[model samples]
Target: MITRDMTALRAVNGGHALLRAYDFIICGGGTAGCVVARRLAEGGKATVLLLEAGGSHHVPAIMDSTQWMWNIGTERDWDFVSEPSVGLNGRTPPMPMGRALGGGSSINGQVWARGHRNDFDSWASLTGDASSSYERVLDIYRRIENWHGRPDPRRGVGGPVDITLPESPIPLVEALIASADGQGIPSADDINTDPMEGDGGCGLPNVLVRNGVERVSMATAYLDPVAPLPNLHVLVGAEVERIGLRGSHVGSVVFRRFGQRYEVEVIREAVLSLGAINTPKVLMLSGIGDPAELASHGIPCHHALRGVGENFQDHILLGGCIWEYETPELPRNNAAEFAFFCKSDASLPTPDLMPVLEECPFASEVTARQFDLPVGPASAWTLAPGLARPKSRGRVRLRGADPALVPAIETNFLSDPDDVRALIRGVEICREIGNDLRLAGFRRREVMPGALRGGDLEMFVRNASGTYFHQSCTARMGRPDDPLAVVDPMLRVLGIEGLRVADASIMPEITSANIMAPVVVIAERAGDFIRQTHGLG
Candidate 1:
């Protein structure tokens, strides 16, 4: 149901005639898209059309944060698969993404981490835009999030999304943090308290779930709050097929809804918030990618931008680190209640590795697919150590012109030797924490690479590593002089008028933490740019 909020952006579309024109057409009403929609439509100033490819986020199983694992690979997921890589022993990996209104926020682990200061500052430096500086992004974060746990005025208070530190952490988590401390990793009260200062050691996860059960996502926070707005029309189950280009600007966006095709004329502009994977695919499908690549799929090149689908980077973590605790306790929200970041090699600039502390037997996907796992009383905790900022990059290319067909995603995980070495250090750090006396009571023993070291461990990483689901930089926003920049520092498509790209895809580089927070910040700023550009606000 399209919410009818009159005070905010009035969004009421009754027929095809009403859909003929819109001030803004936002594609992919997922994580970042929802934010863009609400902000743009504020005070009934702009008629915004938000098209989500999936249905609403009312699923009880999905809304309940604990049932996140069940949503993966299900209908609610994009279910994109990566190409076979030598790292996984020629086995392709499954890349599950949220397909509904709130996007990944509806089905993710709810860990809302706003990466380190270096993350955003680096983007500001790369794009030569002070608007994306860490200080500006931090203020935007305060506006986007409603801190439920702490009353830190520094962290926004009455914002939309409800973010909180872990609730009633289990004993095992305490032990793990202590163990991490023993390994020279400092203890962090929270990741958001000052990311640069609390950058590493043992840290608590700032989750999106409130009161242990209820979830807070873009739909619940941003969209639903302004549901009564008449200027904001949220069309669910509307998959944008291709963006029709005009002589000098975008003419219309063709989408399919309920088995019927619909084309909405873009009066002002269109924003792509289709995430890292689908964003590039949509660009390529719209004849905006590399000339040769688009031609290969029989897609006529309208605006040949070679960097549209290139420079794809994702955080791939080797889940080979595991442990079976005899009586370990876990959190009510998600198993991964605690975490820490560290530089595997001090010579590296920032922390290149982060170890996620999950209170369960988390083995490789290969093991989980063909093996049995225990839960709660029958289970123990595991340390899933991963590389933080990977140097290896990949791409998503169109397989065909069909909109329903997914693109071929190649993450190229562990392709960089430096990335491999970083993960090695992560594993070594985990081993150090696992054997520390602080967790002696809960540590049963290493479930993977029991006694193996050196080359054997490297081989284990090749077979056990998987994506952290933090994919970014497919439609990277870079310097004007850089030939590979798909979008400018302002997030406007390089050669396309009436079009812009927001979301994780526009990130010049992936953040050092979970990407949800950064996505919100990007959308917040994007909304500002749009309003300022078109004189809406």
Candidate 2:
């Protein structure tokens, strides 16, 4: 009974009419949810209901490019904190996720990085699906991007997402690229293209900003245009509790809005694009996870999918190698713009280290206190070395049956010895680039880990270590025979019919760069599968 009026559909807080059933119910109006909902509803072949736990994405802090950081810890953010990590000297770091309509795309750094070719190739190998290969994923990328830079056959034009290189990159950014080039990492015209396919390279990254001013999130690019569609209904502030299943098939979605509980039937499918954490939490709550874990929460297991919350992965970034600027320069574009991808060791097959240049000093609280770093953004710059291919794995578990409580998150960052070794090498590479002769004019002094080596340097990496906000791989896709596989190659949840996951949680492995682009690819592919399955044009 939801109306199709554009203004009325902006955000239905409460007191909105509810239809008995919809052709599709997409939970969590995040990046993937926005894309899937648009695709399913635009064909006019079906009715779709998109539910978002948070409010709208029209806030100034989310729209303005420079004010992106301001959204963290605000009402728009799901300020999740990880348990104390033994690797970081028992520190519990904050893991902020966007709760607004656009999800992380609204509050993220806006770096548009289509992961390396190997990242997708590995997915193909794991799921035994050629469509998941790099060649196929590249085609999808081409079809989705509205590239603003020099025309290239590898990139798409006239697509929904506006992608562009920094129009006027600050001098230091150029110097950082030069410094990286001097250290054997060649600079490329566009890192998302041919550069990422090879071993690795440095370049000015593409951003999801329009006219170098406003952020073009997935919600803006995909959802907003189709908001007026009569078949599509969007509900904001609707937090889903669980998926109601009739035996093996998902029948309905139960959610809470304004402290009122409601259940809406799903005529065809129920897609969960609720991110890495919430996706598995919802599944487990619906009696679809490990049997013992569900029993502990006093919930009976309807389906025993042991991989519901396992294989959790995230890119680890050390908050940085800081250098006081000789002269303060105003930040341009996304504050953290320039980036380089490279191998920590020569023997490694692909690039494992991704160091991004932050236009301001970026550090963890522990590292900042340990180093006594400057707080002013204009005073210094940071080269945050991120572990692109971390071997360590973690898991998410339910605290209790209550849907209101946050799930227990175990990031387990830097738990693997190899991860520590790789990060140490990454820090060395960052230090070498920060002090290179090409950056002499910009560097006043090296702030932290100046000459530390051996155990001291390792300690620095641990203290500075934090998440890149690319949480994924918990409810991963794999072959049916694979015991830990939660979803199949087509993103359908194992042992559950009419239920699919189209988000970062479906990644078989963490990609070798910012995961936003890879996530969009997942969502697009999901849309294709769902469309073909139901005969939607």
Candidate 3:
């Protein structure tokens, strides 16, 4: 039986239609989309419509924090595969994104890192929004998170997203921490609350997990609210086709479900949260992208937005040595072995540590380079060094006029020599952190990937490098003079009005850490942007 909340969303025609003209039409009811939808609907400030490409998240596996990734390649995933990469010796990469109501947050490892303040400030500098200041962003961050495990004045106590440290830790983790201390890297009691830069020690990493489960995703925190708001509607299994534009302003979006296509006109504005890969595709389908590329695909250019699919950036990673544990039993649940944050050139204050039990891989080498790292053999304890600021540019182009066809994504990973050098540094740091004598009691010899010894180090890097899977910036935001920019500082797709992209796609540069938190922050700010524009705030 459909709950009252869902029944109120159903249209008279058996669809979800809450208002004659929705104040906001949010496409892709994923991470950022849900937050925006929930906030807008909470106070009945506006009628919000949220459309999702995939269906419900009621399955037991989806809620299981440890086995959530098993949902990959299943029915609920977009299952996007990247174009062949020149960097990975011509192998293609598989990028599994969440298609359910919560988007990737529903199936991610649930690790939560707010990243560095400089990352947000850099975006503000480019966008020219002084309000994008670090302090302001921190305010938004604190407002959204409900830290449960410990008392942190820096952490918000009552928010939708539940943040906490690991419930179960491996013995190796203790050793890694000791090793960091041994190296004079002071322990940062709370990395999430501490400063992003400077000589700092490792802290107990936080995650978007609660009661050993994932939380703060779109469905859990946003869509699960009580009904009768009278302005919000959610539709699942609805795939957006294109955004219909009226001259310079977007009029509505056309989407399809169950062999029937419908168009919903937006009285005010529309937001796209289809992630970095699909946002540009949606734009090009709606006749926005590089004029030459669109024209080649028989799409008469409505706008010659040359940068619509440019400025792509992502973090390339290498796996660490899978040393056997004295306990000798593989962890039954999803617990990070540890995490590490390192520099691009292996020269930094110190590496922030993370423990990971899973890794992202592809069937071929071609797809892995989209993030600018060569598909090489390397391993770490999930130590990832993101290409915080990348110089290389890539594109997302329509395969055809068929909106059903996913746009072909090409990320020229390692196009810049600097990205590769940083990843190499990451590999070295992982080895050092992994083999620290402080954790020696748990260290068994190298297992699956083999030892990282003299002649084998290069081979490990060449064979082991993989994607951190945080792809972004295909529709980058920057100053108007920035040649490769797709959106203005306000995140409005340039040359287009009444339309905005709020997912990771609009990031000027990928953050140095996981992106779930930053994406939500973008949505929070964008919600305000929409409200202020409409005089509703």
Candidate 4:
């Protein structure tokens, strides 16, 4: 039998030679978890331990920007499946979120749009915290990276994450810009500015790419530097089953490695960055969810908070219109432009209508399953939008106590009549834009079973509209007055001490833009909140 020294693994309850317990234990070293780890470890005051459920982020598929998406369902992704949706004709689609060291940030399209200022301020208003304020969150956003080396006061400079326009080599992106411009859609130089909603922007799609590689991922930006720190440790391929509790405080986490279960104690706090799906599952499994639900599954309840898995919301993206351009050689490498528009053409009192982009297809769609749609020789893309600030909320519940079984995610899309109307409007607008004269030279005709004047278009939409993958709202942050609120304003779990949820799950509402950049910003701010509350140097 292979064995090690017993003393080496033994814990020293109280001793001077003993390494201090981590000031923070971050689970799911993903987009936000990485940022949180880095910010806390920057000054070397707090000990940080980051645990990731997946394997390494150094996979070859992660480096190649175009093929990065291919890594989704492979070992790198959590491969979570949502509950069958009645809204999308009872189809249960797969939600491929990165389960690796860098989490979804490493495998995503790398778009770096920061969404609207109002998105943050709305969150702040809900939480009653100034840090959640738009201006405060904007400061955190600017602190992350240089925005394409420009001297824009709005963009951050000299940060770890490198933000820039997508490099050429993906040419369909460029033609999309030209198409939008020809249609009189206004081009935005800065998509992250306050009140970010606009008609259309000609600027290149901003990305978290650096030196021809994905850089904004937490593994690259945060843990890469402090991983060797004596106080900080990272475990890969570790699946957390539940958090161990004592009275009302989270005492430790029980996880599996190599078919053996191990428990790691946390002296300070345990932060859950397990994304939307797994975060709620962990809470439910740990007896921190609804009492009745736990009792039905033969699991005990630690806290009977009903909001643990409630408030689930994800964007619904519809793939429509294939444009085939007749060119001697396919344009392989060229920069792409972007356009953001209000859902309604009419003006809003304060832009309450959170409709953002119409073209360039990165954040524009979060595909639940990419291969489900039929592909052909001509470049096939989608025109996607979901009601960004959706009024309807869903839930993530447990099928059983088993962590291996994926949680039941009910993404109540188009539950609101207005959201359905918005999708219909989005489809109509995308068709109009695709059929414009500017695209006449580039596109041959619609290849799908749909036509300009047929019911097949409706059939196509019914069959094809898929999940945008921007899942959030479970364990949401809100004031004590709101019954649906899971976490309090301080990012702390209600009725539980020394525990927090610091990823997309805590977002009061999903942002209109791609979530990677915003998730990082959220972690950055959360790091500060943790430090200040704990009085860390």
TM-score of each: 0.94, 0.97, 0.88, 0.88
Shift in Å, residue 437, candidate 3 = 2.2
lDDT of 2 by residue, 137-250 (tens): 989999899999888888999889999998788888888888899999999989987768998999999999876778999999999898877788889988998999999999
* lDDT (C-alpha) at residue 116 in model 4: 70
Q: Please provide, for model 4 over 1-537, each residue's C-alpha lDDT reduced to its tens digit, 9 standing for 90 to 100.
A: 212122223211121122334567888888888888777777777777677778777766775554565686788887877676666667666787887888887787677767676678788888887778877776887788767744677778877877776555344445555665565544455556533634323445576666554345667777777665565666676688888899899888777766666667788888999999889999999999889999989999889888888888776655544443443222221112343444444443223222222222232132324323334322444444344555557898899877777778887655675665566655666556666675566555544333434454443454555566688888899888888788887788999999998888988888766677778877776787788888875
Stretches off by above 4 angstroms in model 3 are 1-20, 226-228, 329-334, 344-392, 448-456
Tell me the tens digit of each residue's lDDT in model 1 across 262-335: 77788899999989998998888888989999898798899878898899988876665677775655546765
Model 3 accuracy (lDDT, Cα): 0.68
Which candidate tops TM-score?
A: 2
Cα lDDT for residue 436, model 2?
Answer: 92
Note the clash tally of each candidate. 14, 0, 41, 8
Quick one: best lDDT, which candidate? 2
**Model 1, which residues run further than 4 Å from truth?**
1-18, 149-153, 195-199, 328-331, 367-378
Q: Please write out the lDDT profile of model 3 over residues 11-59, one tens digit for every residue.
A: 3223544454567899998888888787667777677888888887666
Cα error, candidate 4, residue 239 (Å)? 0.9
- Could you tell me the C-alpha RMSD of candidate 1 in Å? 3.7
